[model samples]
Target: MPNALIIGASRGLGHEFVRQLAGQGWKVFATARNDAALEELRGVGAHACKLDVARPESLAGLGWQLDGESFDLAIYVAGVFGPREGAKSAPTRQDFDLVMHTNVLGAMQALLLVAPMVEAAKGKLVFISSDMASIADASSSYGWIYRSSKAALNMAVRSAASDYPGATFAVLSPGWVRTDMGGENAPLEASESVAGMLDVIAGLKPEESGAYRNYAGKTMPW
Candidate 1:
């Protein structure tokens, strides 16, 4: 069975990835911050670990726990949508910290730990980014902080790709899916978005490493 690791499997896109991958008979190692979420992942046939991406110590423990394991696929899906404020509305210090730490810093840290494992298996590494992170496509300043964080994440993944040539890296945008973060009226469904992303991942080539694409496989502007 192909081995896969999901960095954040608690809910939304992360949980959806677990469900689909596990149901397809992949040996999935997943992580969540809460006990209940962990249990849910277990119920879905995933080997679940307790992890809070915002906590460096928790991530350190995850690195130790997953030591020596080679994953055919590893995804960094832990992120938070911070204040829904515009450019004029400054985010509070706490919100800024929380958003940046979870979305950018945590991902950067996880990449350092997970990239080698993916390289060992010659696998693919995916970072769940957002279309809002696109600089050329920017139409508004809404969720400025969150957008900035993801943009930083995009750059981080792109820069890291050259160092880990054995593994392919992708930064994907899942679109406006109806999740806790996307709210109820979003056009896409979690299942649809994830399925599309899976297809995109399956078709990824090493030459495409660090490419930013949408769930539907359309390349996006950086």
Candidate 2:
């Protein structure tokens, strides 16, 4: 069985990823900010790690903890929300700080930290990016923070892909899934989104690196 690491595994797509991967016989290393929320995965073939990905010290701790373990797949779902109603004009520094830090920097931090393990095993790194990042599909301008941060993530994934020739690095837009983050009106369910993505990942060949795509394995324009 392959070992998989999923960050931000407490809820939303992250939680579902852990569940589905576990059911498929993977030994999962699950990370969530709340150690308690991760408790739900107990006895579910997951080992929990608490991490606030944006914090250097916390991520350093995670690195230390994983010193000897190697994983075949690493998925990142840790991110933050954009401007919500009244929090605009006078947006607290914390809000702005969190939006960029979590969505952009935290993801890079997590990927960088685990790159060695993924590289050693010739594993895959799947980023839960958004379709909002595609400038090619930008017919409407919306969701500033989330969109821009995901755009940045696509670039970073491209760069990382170039740097690691032997590993699989993919940026996938999970589609409009019905999660707390995706809202009630989103078209896809959590299970649908993750299952489709897993199928895509399963079929990825080394020849197809540095591509920006969606959950269903369709090529997406960057």
- Per-residue lDDT tens digits for candidate 2, residues 38-124, read 688665668988788888899999998788887788898888777753314455667667888998888888878887888888888
Candidate 1 Cα errors over 4 Å, as ranges = none
Model 2 residue 102 CA deviation in Å: 0.7
The lDDT per prediction is: 0.96, 0.84
By how many angstroms RMSD does model 2 differ from the true structure? 2.1
Residue-level lDDT tens digits of model 1 in 77-137: 9999989989999789999999999999999999999999999999999999999999999
For this target, which candidate reaches the highest lDDT against the unseen true structure? 1
Best TM-score among the predictions, by candidate number: 1
Off by over 4 Å in 2: 84-93
